[model samples]
Target: MIKEQGLSVQHVCQSMSIGPTAVRRWVEQYDSEQAGQPGIGKPLTPEQQRIRQLEQENRQLRGDVEILKKGVGLLCPRAEMSFRLIDELQTKAIPVSQSCRVLGVSRSGFYEAKRRAAAPVVCKASVHLRAAFVASHQSYGSRRMVAELSNRGIAAGRFKVRRLMRQAGLKPVWKRKFIHTTDSKHDLPIAANVLARQFNPAAPNKAYVSDITYVRTGAGWLYLAVVIDLFSRKVVGWAMAPSMPAKLVCDALHMAVQQRRPGEGLIVHSDRGSQYASAQYQAKLASHGFICSMSRKGNCWDNAVAERFFLNLKMERVWQREYANHAEAKIDIAAYIVGFYNSERLHSVLGNLSPSVYERNMAAKKPIVVSEFT
Candidate 1:
């Protein structure tokens, strides 16, 4: 082969492992070639060059097919006959069967696509919606997504949003539940229902709702007691402990006392739970010169403010976590209650302002005595 390209006979024998006879035959072919085009190498005819180009193109196409096959195998490894079927369908121009056979997508998948025709796709529009959804921390479910779409002036229904979420494998990270955390089962003398189902407070610190909730953790269960100011809907004081003893509620009350130092007649309402009704708890309230109020037995509505707070806490935070133990739950709950709930969470009744913001607003307003001394 080398001698045919004008190499010396001995060089061909040594370099190419060609025997003497093969080298002599190649030298003979080279002499014939040089006789035709004297010392120039033989050139390929047009057909041979065309064939070479076609062969190169075929090899490149095969390489691409192998890469595509590998990707499809990785994505849907269990399924067989992916790109091969796609290519066959493409060649035959039978997209429907090709989609079903190659993609291993069922007839139903094709029908679904046909029934729900692929909408006019715009890369920019999809990019915007995906960016918005992602920027929301995936906290938005179909309802919120639909609302967002509407806000962005994009026409979309809840079902459509749900379908898109399914396609994108997205879900809302937050959920809701009915929380029944108040254990009003203490033997202590219950206070009068002074709040009287009146949750509205005309001034900050005038009325507060207290409740206790259980958060599971590694150590055990961490009990959280909170006093929410009714006027501002702000959690003034919160305490977390390993149990729901009187001290749990007492610490929370003390926090409120230290923080607000409301006038000598602030009314603090709670259910007839032992934590609140305990003698020690009542004495603490008296020490702060605060009036104690209790909800009637089994009537959660009487302490609705506290109930609502617990509900929101569970819905927004607790429901989303799997507590490993008491300590972990405490840390997460503390962060949620103090870091997010009290300071950042927007309450609809508070005109969508956080409790801190609402309290600041209330403090800005002049207090008007709506209730008079008897």
Candidate 2:
């Protein structure tokens, strides 16, 4: 017993720290040393050993049946095929996380495949919504996407488009808040508040609104002066300059006059700025027989049409770009105003028609009348 246990009995004698009285009886009981040989099993034949190895391998291969069942229930597509291959690798005692890392598949994708398989419906609508969203530079929201899909002859409502947008993880670029940059602080002879938020014009050229907005550039600040026809809310003329001088406003008004050749008594509305109140600008307006109308002190709503135009310009174009200088901004902004905004973009107030289209439609609808002043 002592030999099989590999030494004993006298071990207690070596530990005298335990009092002799307590260990003395234990030593006396184990005093007799009975030796016994270590046991060894009989060796198995080579054939039996091979059989045992095969049984162990069979057990391991049978363990993969669970992974096989999961693969059977996964969604069928090229995306799921990738995950299916990952699952097969996982059955080989490989960690699922490790297989995901090796195959470059997110765990979310693996889980999403299982979810889709449970429902098993084709998502053609989501595909079209995703395509439209990508094509618009991700600028169209659910409402605009609904319109775009309808134009493509795909029947989809706003709510369905919104749902598909969420499913596809698609969202449009957000517009930053608009800032007021008009500086109306100047001592000059101002005109009476006549236009007074009367944005709905009876006809084109009856009234025009003007305003100035600032744009940041790498070089410095760039000022843009715009004159808009109140009837269609279209930018009739615009001028970009490094400084906001009276000549800036005059140049834009000059362009509007040259292009439209409006009848006499055209009321031009603007904020109370020195540029608009300057003798030079007043002389130019007088030369064209334009009646000057100014907004009251610090009242932006009086020139709301012009202010809205600037807001559209910034939110739709300028905010998305970083111009190196005024020249670059001029080219791009001119393209947006002429090529896109006025010609192609739809306005809800214009009944989803572009400004040019709306003007033509209005002209077709209304009969001509003599000038009010005449």
Candidate 3:
């Protein structure tokens, strides 16, 4: 987790209230960490290091005192935080003198900071909750964030989570303005929109949607075609290439059928793009007994759910990046979908569950509800 976060040893020590030696000892256990990536080596002089430490301490103390003033009904939150840090560091085998200097703490006030008073529950909760928020890649908003906290045995009300998130200046990644990429003007046979915007499937693989989206790479443009199961919104399969073509969608369908093997008459929906409506793409779907459904010409809303998946893919990952080539974009987008989006990213439509988790729970229950999440 530390390697994934890419924080230096000193930051890790501060975040976990451990000493530098303890952090090194613990992180050395990670294969990625022990592999020795090149690290930034701007050596800080003693005075400069002291200044940085003072700034960090100042921020912590300011945050503590501000939280105390926010109707949390705690007195001297900074003092409480100081004592807690001291205790935690000591428990991890760090000397008081060593930690004090690093944290910009004063030795003369050590006894005063150690007052035996009960700390505010809210304050304690925030530390652990903040860690969880960071662990989530700052993707979870308050509702999902509350669920994440609960999973870690940190019980916090949704309102408190919202308030804390606002206070901490954390915000969920947001969707950008829309653009339609469907090319429905071609003179190709288009199937009727049999799916008809009915996005919530009763079970996995019963209904699937495919759409092509593009990312700007330095070389030119990289296009991606994705097949998503409507039941849980999981991207079952995807293919990325330098150009959008029938082969792209065909390859995506092949992978989807290979992985999921949806039974006969499974509805495969897409916009009436030439690629999707072409003989090659339709033949692949027919081979697997997939019932092809196309959105009406000039009507992207008929495939709203597929469009939404593309929106999220761009907003959460693609939009922020400037890829050097098709290969770079392909690798990054694939990792985003498989590594983070499918397995970990929470979806509100899935009742704050990851798509795979929701799918598993649905399989266990096996009940048909129109609103699966509700």
Best candidate per TM-score, number?
A: 3
Q: What lDDT tens digits, residue by residue, belong to model 2 across residues 243-271?
A: 98999999998888877778888899999
**Model 3 lDDT per residue over 1-374, tens place:** 77787889998778779789867766655543233322233345777667767877898988876664453324435755665677788999999897565555676677654542332455577887778776665666788888887776777889998888888888867757554566777888979889988999777778999999888889997788999999899999899888787999999988988787677878999988889989999888777777999887778798888888787778777776789998989898999898878998788899888898888787778764332210
Give me the overall lDDT of model 2. 0.77
List ranges where model 1 is wrong by over 4 Å: 1-187, 364-374
At residue 100, give the lDDT of candidate 3: 66
Off by over 4 Å in 2: 1-140, 168-172, 175-180, 367-374
lDDT of 1: 0.72
Question: lDDT by residue for model 1 over 1-374, one digit each (tens)?
Answer: 56346777687678878688866765676776544422334576777667767877898987976776567768766433443455456687777674665454576654554444455443334555686576544555666566556556666777777776777777656555444666666567988899997777677778989988776655676778999888878788989887778998999988887777777789999988877878899998887678999988888799888877776677667776789987788777778777877776556577656688777776667654333222
Q: So what's the TM-score on candidate 3?
A: 0.63
Clashes of 3: 0
Query: Worst ten-residue run, lDDT, model 3?
Result: 32-41
Choose 2 or 3, whichever is better by TM-score. Answer: 3
| Each prediction's TM-score versus the true structure | 0.54, 0.61, 0.63
Position 160, candidate 2: lDDT: 77
Pairs of residues at least 3 apart in sequence or in different chains that clash in candidate 3: none
